[model samples]
Target chain A: MSTSIVPSERAADRGALAAPLDDGPRQREARAGRRRSATRIALGGALPILLIALWYAATAFDWVPAHKLPSPDAVIVAGIDLWERGLLGMHITISVQRVLLGFAIGAAAGLVIGAIVGLSRFADGVLAPTVGAVRAVPSLAWVPLLILYLGFGEDSKVTLVAIGALFPVYTTVAGALRHVDPHLVEMGRAYGYTRSRLLLTVQLPAVIPAIISGLRLALAQAWLFLVAAELVGSTMGLGFLLIESQGNLRYDRLFLAILALGVIGKTTDALIGIGERALLKRWG
Target chain B: MSLSQRTTTLESPALPVSLRGVGRSFGSGRKELPTTVLRDVDLDVTAGEIVALIGPSGCGKSTLLRQISGLDTPTAGSITIDDRSIAPADQRCAMAFQEPRLLPWRTAARNVQLGLARGLDRARGAERVAELLELVHLSHARDQRPREISGGMAQRVSLARALARGPGVLLLDEPFGALDALTRLSMQDLLVDIHAAEPTTIVFVTHDVDEALILADRVVLLGSEPDLPGATIRRVISVPGSRPRDRADAELGELRAELLDGLGVPSHHSHH
Candidate 1:
C-alpha cells in the first residue's frame, strides 16, 4: 500500500513541475525564484513557532517551575498589566527618544570631525591617534565617567548613548572619506571646486553608501548604550523595568521586558534597512 | 540652426597660450634625488589652433598638458594664456582626462553642469547644460548615470562638461584613448566639428600618430634625447589640412609614417 501511494505522489509532483516549465524559461525561473523565497520565509518562521510551542507545552505539562520560566501567556498578561497602568508606553517612548536624540547629536559631530581628519593630513596626524585610543575603550567603561561628569539624570544617560553612537560613524566616515577615488577628487579640483565646495559636491556624494552604513551601525550602538544607561541608574525605561521586575521576583514581567527590547531593536534595524535601500537606489 | 552653430554663440573667444622654459621634476626633497619629467619645454599655441602632443609612453606629454591647464605648475618656467600669467586651477582653461571621470551618482546633464561658470543664474546654467548635451549628441542620454552609459557615451559627456566651461583653451589628455577603434574615429571627427564651431584653442595629448595627423593643425613631438635627463619638444610638424580632412589622404599617410618613425616605431611603409 505504501509503495503504491509513493508512485502516485511522485507522478503528481512531476506533473505540477512540468506545468510551469511549459510557460517558457523566464516565466518558469520567475516562478521558481518566488517559490524559493516563500520557502525561505516559511523556514525562517518555523523555528520561532516551534520554540513558542515548546514553551507552552513545558509550562502546561509542569515540566519547568513557573518561578524560573514563565509561560508565553503569562508574559503577555504581564505586558497587558503594564499597559493598563500606562507604564509600558511611557517606557518605550522614553527609550526611543533617548536613542534618537543621542544618535542625531553623535552623528553630526562625527561627520564634521571625520571630514576634518579625512581631508587634512595635519588634522589626521594630530587627532587620529587620540581618537583611536578613545575608541578602544569599551562601551560600558564610558558609563562611570559619563555618570561622574554629567550626573545620573537624563544628561548622563543621553551622553552615554551619544558616546556609543559616535565611534562607529567617526571611524567609517573618516576611513571612507580618505579612500574616495583620487581621480574624481582631481577632476573636482580641475573644475574649480576647492575647500568646502569640493567636500560637499564630490567627497560626500562619493561616500554616501559608506555614510549610510555608518549611520546604521551608529543607530544600533545608540540602542545598546540606551539600555546600558537605563540599566545602571534609570528610574524608568525598559531597562528599568528589567531591574524592577527582578527585584520584585516577577519573572513574567522580566521576560516581557526582554521580549519588548528584542522586538523594538529588530523593528528599528528593519526601518534603517528600508532607508538604506531607498538611499542606495538613489546614490549607489 | 545646427547644434554647433547655435551653441557657438555662447562660447568665449579663444585665447593664445605661450610657454617659456617650462619644466617639471619630482622629489626635490633634501634627502632624495630629483627626477625630471620635462625640462626646458617651450611652445606657442595660437588662438583657435588645434595642436597635438604625441610621444612614447611615460614621455611627459600629459605633464605638459597639465602645466598648460594650470593643474600642475612647471618647476622652471612661465606659462601665459592671453598674456595673463597662469595660476593654479586657472579659469582660462578646462581639461578632460583620458578617463571620463564622471561622478557615478550624477546624470549626464548634471555632470555637464559641473563645468558651468560659478554663480551663473539657474536658468542659464540649465540651458547651457542642455546645449552641451545636444552638441555631443547625448541628449538622449542626458538623464542617464555614468555607469548606465557605454565608454564612448561617457567620454562624450566628459567632453560636453569641459566644453560647458566656455574655456579660453581646452586641454585633453588622451580623452579617447579608452574607446574602441571605430568609436575613436567618430570621436576624432566630432572633436573636429566642435573645433570648427567654437574655435577654442585646443591642446591634446595622443599616442596615435594617425589621430594626430587627422585632428591637429600642428603635431608637436616630445621625446627624451639620448643624454638628456627629461623629455622635451623634439619635432614639430605642420599638418597641411583643413577641417574634415580625409583620413586616407596620401600626405596624411606620409606624415603619419614620419611621426611613427620619430616615436621610434618602424612604419612598415617602404621608401621609394
Candidate 2:
C-alpha cells in the first residue's frame, strides 16, 4: 500500500501519544538506537566465540576423549584435505542437484494442485482429506517404502525429498488463495469480469506473497529430506560422507561434513530471502 | 465512439429510469426477520436530468439507487428503464460508489479501460482511456497505480471508468463522501462539468444538503423513520434556473434551508 498523508499523519499522532509525556529529541533517539544495536551485535557475537573457546579449552586440557570430539584445528585440517582431494565439491554438487530437482517437482505439483483445490469446492472435498492423511505420515516414513518401489537409486532419494516438500507448499498456498480479499472479488464483478478472468487477474496476484513464502518452506524441507534419503545406500553426497567418516572413526571429517551441511543450508535460505525481497518489491 | 458501442443496446430512446412503488427488504426466510429498507418509493428521472437523493443516514437513499441500477432488486414493485425491466448484469446503468473501489494492482489508465464493453479494439480502447483520464484531469496519473494517487484523484478515475461505457443512466452513491472539504467541492464542480459534457440521466445519492441544491435539477428527500416499515419519499423539490448556477445564489440558499427543514433540522440562517 501507498502511505498517504492522512493515514501517516494519524500514525504519527498515535506514536506520539504512545511515547512518554516528554519525548527525546530526534538526534538523541537516532544515536540511542545505533548504540542499542551495537550492544546487541556485540552480545550476539560473544556466545559463538565463547563456545569455540570452550571447545578449544576442552581439547587443550584433554577434558574429553580426543576420539569423541575433534579439535577445531583438526576439523579445519580435515576440511582443507577434502577440498584438496576435490571430493568436497563433488559431494556438494550432487546434494545440491538432488535438492533442486526434488524441490522443483514438488513445488510445481503443489502450485497446480493448490490452485485446483483452492478454487473448486468439489476438488477440495474429494482430494483434501486424502492429502491430509498422507501428509500426516512422516517424511522419513516414506523412505523405505519408496526405495522398495523405485529401488535404492537417485529416483528413491528424489521421491523422498519431493514428498517432504509437497505438503507445506500445498497447504500454505491453498490457504492463501482461499482467504483472498472478498472486496477485490466484488470489485472484479463490478468491472464485469468473468469468473476465470477474476481468478487470474485479481486472486492470483493477491496470493503471490503467500506462494513465495510456501516455496521457501518447501525448499528447506526438501533439503532436510535429501539428507535423510541419502542415509540409505547412497554412494556420494554430504550424507554419504557423514556416514563414511563415522564408520572410519574420523571425527574431524565428520565434523567437517556436518559444518558444510549447516553452511549450505544457511546460504540457500539467504538466497531465497533475497528472492522474496525482490518479488515483494516488484509485486507487493 | 463507434468502436465503444455498449454491449447491450437499450431498447428505448435515451432511456429515462422509472421506479414505481418500489420497496426493498433484506433477510427474508423461515428463520430470519425481513427488514424493509425502502417502501413505496416512486421516482421518475427523465433523460438528462440530474436528480440528487438526499436524506439522513439509513433513510434508504442508497438502497433505492441500487434497486434502480439492478444491483439489487426491490421486493415489492418493479423498476424499469425506458419502460423495460433491466438485469443485474446490464451495462445501461453504470455506478460509482462512495469509495473509489479501483483495483489496487491496475494502473489508473488500465482501470479506466475496464469500463469499455466487449467489441472495442486495443487502439480505440487506449484512445478512449486517454480521453477519459484527460477529462478527469488525471492524464499525468494514467500510469500510476491506485495506491500512488490521492483519494480525490482515485475518485476521479472511478468516475471516468463509470462514464467510459457510455451508459444511458449513471448512478452515484455519495461519490465524494470520502474526500476532504476542498476536494469535495472541486469534485462536485467536476460532476457538473462531466454532466454538461455528456448528458446522461443521473441519480446521485448524498447526505450533503447544499451539495444536493448545487448540482441537481431536483432534490429528493427520504425521511428517516426508524420504526416504520421503510423510508418513503418525503419530498421532491425542483431546483430552478440553468446550468452553472452561482454557488452563492439566494434561491439555492433558500432551497437548502427548506430541504434541511424537511429532515427535521431547522436552519439558523432561515430563522434570522
Candidate 3:
C-alpha cells in the first residue's frame, strides 16, 4: 500500500513541476487582468455615453426649450466661437496657472508645518488649537479678507486658492506622520540613525501614500477656491466666463464654461492619480 | 573542548558586555505610580560567548537585552561593552527584534544595508550587505521585499541586517519566537553555523529551555522573588559542551529538567 501511494504522489509532484515550465497560470492571469481593466473602462464610459445620447434626443425632439437647455452642438459652437476670439485659451491657461501656483505654495507650507507639528508635542500643543479654529472659519469668509489685504488682482485670487489647498494636506500629513509605525522607527533608532536621517529613511517613506492622498484632496480644494476667487472679481477665467455668459443671457456659452471646468478639473485629478500610482509602486 | 579553551583559541573581535546593578522602572511621572520591571541585575559575558537569557513571562528578559543594546536606559546602574559605557544606540552593538521589523518597502539587500555604519563608503557597504545576506542563507532573496518572503525568511533578513553592522556585540530578543517549530530548529542550527563562521558576543532572550541548552555556553535564568518588586538574575548555569552540542545528550537532558523545574514547570522525571 505504501509503495503504490508513494508512486502516485511522485507522479502528482512531477505533474506540478512540469506545469510551470510553460508559465501557463502566470500568462493566464496577465490576460485576465488586461481583460478586467478593459471591462472597467467600458463600464465607466457607459453612463456618460448614455447621458449624451439622451441630451441629443431631448434637444432633437424639442422636449426642453432651447433657451434653457441648449443642444450639445450649440455648446460646441459657443466653445468654437470663444476659441476663434482667443478668449477660450486665455481663460483655460489663466485658471490652470492659478490652480497650479496655489497648490504648489500651499502644499509646500503644509508639509513643512505638518512635519514640525507631527514630530514635536510642544508644537502640536501650541499650534493645534489655533489652526483648528482658523480651519473652522468658512473658506468663503477668507475671500473678503484676502481681497482687503492683497487687492482685487491675481494676488488676492491666488491667495484665496492657496488657503483652500492648505488644510487637507496639513491635516493628513500631520496625522500620518504621528502614526508612522513606531516599531520601524525604533528599529531605525537602534541602527544609530540621527533624528533627521531617521525621519527621511523611515518616517517619510512610511507615509508616502498618505501624502499623495493629501495632495490629491488639496488639488480639488484649489480648484474650488479658484472658482470662488474668480467669481468675486476677475477678467479672464472659466469662473468669470460663468458670470459673463449668464449676465449676457448666453446659456450656450455658460454651458461651455461649465463643461470646460469639469474637463479641466478631472484632467488635473487624473494627472495626480498617475503620480499616485507611480509613487505607490515605488514606496507602498 | 570547554568554552574557555575555545574562547582563548580564537582571536575574536567580539566585545565583552558587563552589567552592574542594572535596573529599570517605568511611569515616574507625577500622575502615575512607578512600576519596576528589572532590578539589581548583574552579569558579565565574555568576548565570543553565547549567552541565552531564559525566564518566565514578563520577567524583563527583553528589557535587559535592550539595556545592553543601548535602546533603553537602565534607571539604576550601568552597562558597558568592551569596558566603555554604552551610549544610546551605541555603534558597538546591533539588535534583531522579535518581529523582524524590516522596512516593508525596501528589498532584503537594502534593509540589510540599513545596519551599515553611517560613514562607511558605498562600495564596501554594498559588499558587506552582500556577504551578510549570503551568511544568513538569503542571497537568493536579496531583491525580494519583506512582505514577499515568509516569516522565517524575513527573520533571516533581520539577522543579516543586524550582522551588517559588524558589531562587537549582537543582541536578539526572541528572534525565533514567531517561527514554526521546524523553522525554529533550523534557525538554531543556522545561528550556530553563523557563530562558528564569525564569533561575536551574542546575548539572546528565549523561553525555550532546549534551545537555550543547544545554543548557549551559559544560560542565565531571570525571575522575581515573592517579596521583590522586579525580576533579577536567579541562576546562571554553565552548560558542559562546546559549540553545536547534541540536542539529545543525557547531560543536556538532565540540565533541561533542572532548568524547567527552576522555571516552575514539572519535568517528566519529576512526574514519574
lDDT of each: 0.91, 0.85, 0.90
For residue B45, give model 2's deviation from the true position in Å. Answer: 2.6
TM-score order of candidates, best first?
3, 1, 2
Question: Which ten residues in a row are the worst by lDDT in model 2 chain A?
Answer: A185-194
The reply for model 1, stretches above 4 Å from the true place, is A1-40, A61-63, B1-9
Candidate 1 or 2, higher TM-score?
Answer: 1
Clashes of 1: 0
TM-score of candidate 3 restricted to chain B?
Answer: 0.93
Writing each residue's lDDT as its tens digit, candidate 2 over B221-250 gives 998455677789989999998877888999
- lDDT by residue (B20-101, candidate 3, tens digit) is 9999999999999899999999899999999999999999999999989888999999999999999998878999999999
Please provide, for model 1 over A1-284, each residue's C-alpha lDDT reduced to its tens digit, 9 standing for 90 to 100: 35566877877876788765556687878888999989998998899899999999999999999789999999999899999999999999999889989998988888888888988999999999999998888888888888889888889888888888888889889999999999999999999999999998999998889988999999999988888888887898898999899899999999898888888988888898899999998889
Q: Order the numbered candidates by DockQ, best leading.
A: 1, 3, 2
Interface RMSD of each: 0.7, 2.1, 0.7
Docking class of 2: acceptable
Q: What fraction of the reference interface contacts is present in each model, in order?
A: 0.82, 0.18, 0.82
When 1 and 3 are scored with TM-score, the better candidate is 3
Residue A180 displacement in candidate 1 (angstroms): 1.0
Least accurate 10 contiguous residues by lDDT in model 1 chain A = A1-10
